[model samples]
Target: MPRISRSEAEQNQADRAGPEFLEALARGLRVIQSFDRDRRQLSLSDVAKQVDLPRASVRRTLHTLVQLGFAETDGKLFRLTPRVLTLAGAYLLSNPIASILQPAIDRLSAEINASCSTAVLDGDDVVMIVHASPSRILPLSAQVGFRIPAFASSLGRVLLADLDDAGLDAFLARIQPHKLTEQTIVDKKQLWQAILKARADGYSLADQEVEVGFRSISVALKRLDGRTIAALNIGIHTERGTPEMMRQTFLPKLRSLASELQQQLI
Candidate 1:
């Protein structure tokens, strides 16, 4: 028998536990996410080590990914190409919530004079779907396909807060929080507590984790059936709004907008 590494072991466990529709795709995404801005280029061994797959399995998967145009290699090193954007792009383009939420997001930005956006949870990150900034001057440069970890962004926490206890617990267990800045809550216990508070309060605030001197607040959008599908948020410089001001002024408007979208969704 061959040794099963941690990722392989996790995959096998998921294969047994999850519905048949999920396993392979989940494993493939794990491979794609293993590469990032810092480790843009990787060797076979590097990919295997990062994703915790066996070297042979990683090689085969990397080759498949390369052939699919999602990954590229120069024989010595492999990297993700722009084609990987299709994975996120396709989701954003096809998701109904994004379509319905875009005009609302645009209007919200115009009304508040801040950048507004809609994002959805993808694995452990929030993928930006629709973004509207008040002025081209205060640019919302995190484009539609940008992704950020759930533990560190207001958009992320708003989506996570909508999860049921079991789903939320699973998500929290998977997150490996790191200090993105002095304000980041890297401790799992504190992060979980914060999420609980977000759930109870019906919104979330992220203070300078995604970027220094910038902060955001978000509220989740749900269907009539009570399923959370996406989140709406506003990001601005700390000078514009403190977390308290966000909750007081913008939070109700966000909730109202999300409610209006939910009526359309159902």
Candidate 2:
């Protein structure tokens, strides 16, 4: 019989104990995530270090991924294959929400000549699901599938504001806010107050919180039932306007777009 790898052994134990989890699958997914823009190509040792998995487990996971055509190896270096995009493609194809929002975001970006994105809260971060940018006057941190800390993002605050008290408390308990910039509100009490303000105002803004000289304003995207499912935001260079100027010029448009998006869900 072939030798069972550590991941396989763990999976066997998990299966025997219960059916709620699959350790093998989890490890394989972690291997996939180990490759990103900054670490696009990695050797076996690099992947092992990044995922904190034993060399044997990482090798097995990489082999499985290569066999599935989701990754490729050039003898020594391993990189994700274009086939991996199928995963994102499948998600976009199956989800009408992404399709519905893309056109609107495109139009908005063109009209304002700025970047627009829609994100959903995931764990302690906000994951950008759709992004549209007309120009690159300033660098932006958001892109499709990109994740940013929720504690310091306008999109994050707008989505966080939708949580009920118990849910909000649970989130606050779990997330350790870190200061990303001079303007980042890392204090728990101060962050909670910001969320409360967003909840009352139905929108949120961040100035140099995620990055210096970048500003954003976000409004919640809701369902017909009035539950916020995601957030939509416009990203602008700080040189374009001050915070108050941004609100005065763009808030109405953002609110109108949010309402239009909500109506589409109905």
Candidate 3:
């Protein structure tokens, strides 16, 4: 390799100091995300392809992550360790809303006999912060640190509704809408209309977008200045209840819980 200019190297270092500082870290996290319930253990090549990174860079990053205990490898395959919880748990602990509201969320789950989830908007996805469910299993995936597309879930809609016109338009511009299920909304105009309604009514419902037989209702938890800090949602099995029931029965309780949560923030 040839020697590089000092100024060029300096500029690169400077770029790594601000918002751009996290590019490598972001790519590493994406690599971890590539390993999910379906793809739990991956080889170096597998991680590279999943994250769209060059093999050499991905290898270096993975080696570092393994050394730091964020990941584990058995010569050929790599998997995340339980220690990975520390990263997400740190975020939950540092965020006042998530810390303060977990007990209430657990109570809601216990009372409803359904799954309750809390999430924060992470780009165009809702990143699950806290999820509490009954001892009995549910039809949908509800776990801490899971993420769902913001356009396709009720939890997503509540967070989306908080965005202003410019933010909404920008988000809409980037997404290539697809039908995850027959009920998934693919039209941008219709989505905008739905979000507007959610903002007005203070709750949103998803009748099986990500999963075919599951439905969820959500409301945004707002700060005193009216910014949405997080979303709280309940997922119900569609076979057990009608959409009308979610609206008529669960929606009121969801609203009341959200209202109470907002007061705690103030």
Candidate 4:
């Protein structure tokens, strides 16, 4: 999945949604997105405030979710049910890339004793589709479905490099890049230059840009037609190596793995 700017993503959604679009269904999905790892459970008023919908509408939506086994309520707070995993499971099962990439990623993570992941570009972000971590660590780990800003992440830069000039302009227009860490590049011109460098180098490296003491290196997974389908990355603690080591050691491995994965895709 090539990276799409926020404006382009919105336009795509609008194009797919004809006049027969179901507003209620859209609202229901928004309600689902309101719940996250930090805010696992929310009251009706909380959800209404989060989604900016009326309390009545949120209540109805929550009730429908509970009835359909997507959510559960403990009389006061609403939380997503395990049944919701069905949706993620269905997506993983349906996407051959996700399913086929996991085992190889797991092997890579084990071999390097680091974190490895595959992600697809979404609107202004990259969403992890497959994630493997040494010892399956959780804290400070980016799990499947985790999203990171595309401008500051190595995986994101690789994916963003695939976009053409017009697509890149549209993305920059919609995204106001912010400094996540001291090393983060927020200026549009500077970020654009970084992207261009990644395009020329065939890989991207982010050293503590997303988070201090963390580093990542990534390569784009391209189809035979030269279309970027996803990005593959390896994450490590800053103590593990230097930028030169990452470029010389990990970069080659990531490129090889990305090439292997691309060959597996149609």
Per-candidate Cα lDDT values, in order, are 0.83, 0.89, 0.84, 0.88
For candidate 2, lDDT tens digit of each residue in 1-266? 25545556565767787877766787898899999878999999999999778888889899999999999999899999999889988988899999999999999999989889999988889999999996655355778888899889999999989988888888889888887788899999898999999999989999999998899999999988888889999988889889998788888899999888888896
Residue runs of model 3 more than 4 Å from their true location after superposition:
1-24
Model 1 TM-score is 0.79
RMSD of each: 3.7, 3.1, 3.7, 5.5
Candidate that scores best on lDDT: 2
What total of clashing residue pairs does each candidate reach?
0, 0, 0, 1
Write the candidate numbers in order of decreasing TM-score: 4, 2, 3, 1
Residue-level lDDT tens digits of model 1 in 148-190: 8889888888888887899988887887888878988888888
TM-score of 3: 0.88
**TM-score head-to-head 3 vs 4, winner:** 4
Better of 2 and 3 by TM-score: 2
Q: What is the lDDT ranking, best to worst?
A: 2, 4, 3, 1
lDDT of 4: 0.88
- Candidate 2 TM-score, true structure as reference: 0.89
Alpha-carbon deviation at 225 in model 2, angstroms = 1.0
Off by over 4 Å in 4: 1-16, 136-141
TM-score of each: 0.79, 0.89, 0.88, 0.90
